[model samples]
Target: NQPGEVFYTEYTYRPWIQIDLQQFIVVTHVIKRDIRTPKVPPQDLYGMYVSKRQWDFVNRGARACFFGLTENEYNCRRPITGQYVTLTLEYEQDSYLDALMDLKVFGLPTGCGRSLGMTTGDIKDYQIETSSNYKDIHQSRAMQGIEGWCSSATDMNRWLMVDFIVPTEVQGVILHGWYQMKRMFIYSFVVEFGLQEHTLRLYGEDGLDPKIFTIDSIQDVHILQKFMFLQNILTRYIKIRVIDPSNDIACFKAEFIGCQVYGNKL
Candidate 1:
């Protein structure tokens, strides 16, 4: 939140607000709120842009546009990877002044990794399934929920699966274990993905053979862990099979990081 009068650009041909995230992030949406003034009207039109290079918004072009609103949220059609986000206001006159109450940008800090929509709820509860879940801790809690997915203590061959419903380019996954008691830290796991569940291929160092990723047992349970594929996998389904679970429980929150195979630029 910001004071309405704090951020103001003097009258200019292109009144804009640029935010530096300081690190690359995959931007999903941007929200702008207007600061009502006695004489100056809110911007009627504006452009939103994201880019790795500082001036790419001007070089490549604006990513999207918003119109006829005092406050608006611009959802990017495709996840954009960038270190900078700029919102440029358009006015009919040669020069205009703009004031904003607030500017918010939502994204995942995966550098060039685009979101697969897990954080934004594009992946629903039914789209996620587990081999078995602990009592009352459903698979739906695997992502974006306080209680993450946990497998039954007695269940073997525990695995969590996600169906994107369309072929997506998956680059990596982000995982978080149970945070409260040094529990649910995954020690080792195998990643499998494919267009069909039955014909899934193991994601390995060479993208051809089977390999299990190992994690230190003493690692912090509350910290996020990221696993990147050697090469991007184009698939509709992905499964994480626990090879060695922390305290024999396959429990964790997971986000599959990637983007749609085809979509218009934001």
Candidate 2:
């Protein structure tokens, strides 16, 4: 939430304030508040729009609601699915200055895109274990940080494992390549999961054969790449084994997505 008022300069024409909802959602309504201030009166808001495309902020996006005159809140006739919500000013005055006090958007998450506390700190440091690390670069760094986990260059048997502690329905994983002085990424990797680390099974179409996922090219480096499993797996442990490490170093950041299983057992 932003504090104070957002004002547009006099020279700025058709100024707009945009909010990124982060993920795609089904927006039901939007609220615009104009708290009365002694020095500056509430500026008029003329348009409210939502869009899945980042560039479509104006007329191309779905119109949530429009106010001919000043209004406190706006509601859409139908729900709009989008990741961005934009408020634009449409008026006849060329040099008019507008100020927006506060804006609120109501929506629901599209899918099981919610993080399972990998970067959110719900999963503790001890929960993440690695085979080996390069100097001070530990496994915990993969949770959330610029300097991610880097395995020792000499260690050929490298793997990073996460203990969910409880049974979890893991849907997907968000992987980010490590970058600092030099660029490092995983070219390909294998995913394994099980109730016990000793008897882990490979993630594949068939439970016996190994499934290798390739990163394709170096263009994917330093970007968050998501890999959704073919089917939801119920397990307490998930391990990622590097098959092809770039620069002979397995370095990356990771976040798991899914919800905890209540009654299901392994």
Candidate 3:
């Protein structure tokens, strides 16, 4: 198709493109190319890209790149498996419509969804709130169709702990703030990775567990956000704490990335 023949949405409505895989599949990655304008990609011509599932009205399933495409890549920080994968432009149609030279989606047709975190494993004991489910912390969707985790108290002390049962090689962590219903998003939070020998100890007694990476401040993160460790971390336990007490509400869903290192113990 000629450059002028490229599809452009009517400015009166939101601009977005949806592709129905028709059947459910495990979406592993997505690659987008720029408009066929120059031999080398130009600066300031970049636009934000958000790969999502289902409808765009709801942001629960969104995984976005804050800025325009970085080096023309937007990998799903966490698993994004769905029947319909949608790509949307953050900015509305202005003088020019968002253009796409090419777009690609790579995945498997497993039908069942995927997650990097251990789905059925021992979790740290915590006070259960009737309105909130601790299990939702490991869920994929925020509030798209289900209620995600929300702390009963708002003292900046709320935490969600996960035990992998064995030492795992952790590469990164992806978080989804409460983007459903009232939209109680976690403005900021901190993550800590550790390893322990026994679950009965509650706390590591030998001072062996140490903090690997600290994300002390992140502002205005509403939907899916990903943080990858500088290097792979080997640990058995991972803790996420929401330390900002100003919001009066702290709610989120998260997934940890990496694989299990067989026969390895810390």
Task: Compute the lDDT for candidate 2.
Answer: 0.72
Q: Give lDDT per model, in order.
A: 0.71, 0.72, 0.52
Candidate 3 — what's its lDDT? 0.52
TM-score of 3: 0.44
TM-score of each: 0.56, 0.60, 0.44
* Ranked candidates (TM-score, high to low): 2, 1, 3
Residue 21's lDDT in candidate 3: 68
> lDDT winner among the candidates?
2
lDDT of 1 at 86: 87
Q: Is candidate 1 or candidate 3 better by TM-score?
A: 1
How are the candidates ranked when ordered by lDDT, highest leading? 2, 1, 3
On a 0 to 100 scale, what is the lDDT of residue 169 in model 2?
86
Tens digits of per-residue lDDT for model 2, 1-266: 37875755465567667887856578888887655442434356567778755557655555454544445566777887766787767665564435557788987877544578767778887888888987333433444655777789788977889999988888777788765777766778899999887999889967668878777565646666767677888889999998874448787778887767777444
Clashes of 3: 0
Model 3, residue 111: C-alpha shift (Å): 19
After superposition, the stretches of candidate 1 with alpha carbons farther than 4 Å from their true spots are 1-112, 135-143, 180-182, 216-218, 245-247, 263-266
Which pairs of residues clash in candidate 2, taking residues 3 or more apart in a chain or in different chains?
A: none
